[model samples]
Target: MIDVLYFAWVRERIGIPRETVTSEAATVMDLVDELRAREERYALAFADLSSLRVALDQELTEFDTPLEGVREVAFFPPMTGG
Candidate 1:
């Protein structure tokens, strides 16, 4: 199982903070496809991935990054320095 964490507006749209899921996805993009297919909430939350950033095991990674050996993943809006 992987720990999926949603931050900022991703959580607001999805209405959840985090979840643990078992998936057959091999990469972050694959996982995204799965989530996008789950329901409207997921689809809406992931609709514009370009505005989002991802992390794997707490380290920033690309959407195509493999999920192998990854225990955690986080999704959030692009952070801006104030």
Candidate 2:
């Protein structure tokens, strides 16, 4: 199982801060596909991948990043300086 964390609006949309997911996805995009398939809330939260940033094991990564042995995956909107 992998810990999946959602932040900001993503969390609000999904109605949860985090979850444990059992997945066979090889890449972040693959994992997203699985989540998006689970419910409409997930689909809405992940609707625009371009507006989102991802982190694997607390290190920023791309959607194509491999998920092998990763213990955590976090999704949030792109950060901006105030």
Candidate 3:
């Protein structure tokens, strides 16, 4: 199982802060496809991948990044610098 965390509007849209997912996805994008197929809320939250940022094990990564042995994945909106 992989820990999936949603932050900011991602959490708001999905109505949850985090979840444990048992998946067969080999990449982050594949995992997204699974989630998007689960419900409308997930689809909406992940509709525009360009508007989102992802992290693998707390380190920023691309959606195509491999999920092998990954324990955590986080999704959030892009951060703004002040």
TM-score of each: 0.98, 0.98, 0.99
- Cα lDDT of model 2 by residue, 19-40, tens digit: 9999999999999999999999
**Tens-digit lDDT track of model 1 for 1-82:** 9999999999999899999989999999999999999999999999999999999999999999999999999999999998
What is the RMSD of candidate 2?
Answer: 0.4
Order of all candidates by lDDT, from best down to worst? 3, 2, 1
- Candidate 2 stretches with Cα past 4 Å from truth are none
TM-score of 1: 0.98
Name the runs in model 1 displaced over 4 angstroms. Answer: none
| Backbone clashes, candidate 3 | 0
Question: What TM-score should be assigned to candidate 3?
Answer: 0.99
* Backbone atom clashes (below 3 Å) for every candidate: 0, 0, 0
lDDT pick, better of 2 and 3: 3
Q: When superposed on Cα atoms, how far off is each prediction in RMSD?
A: 0.5, 0.4, 0.3
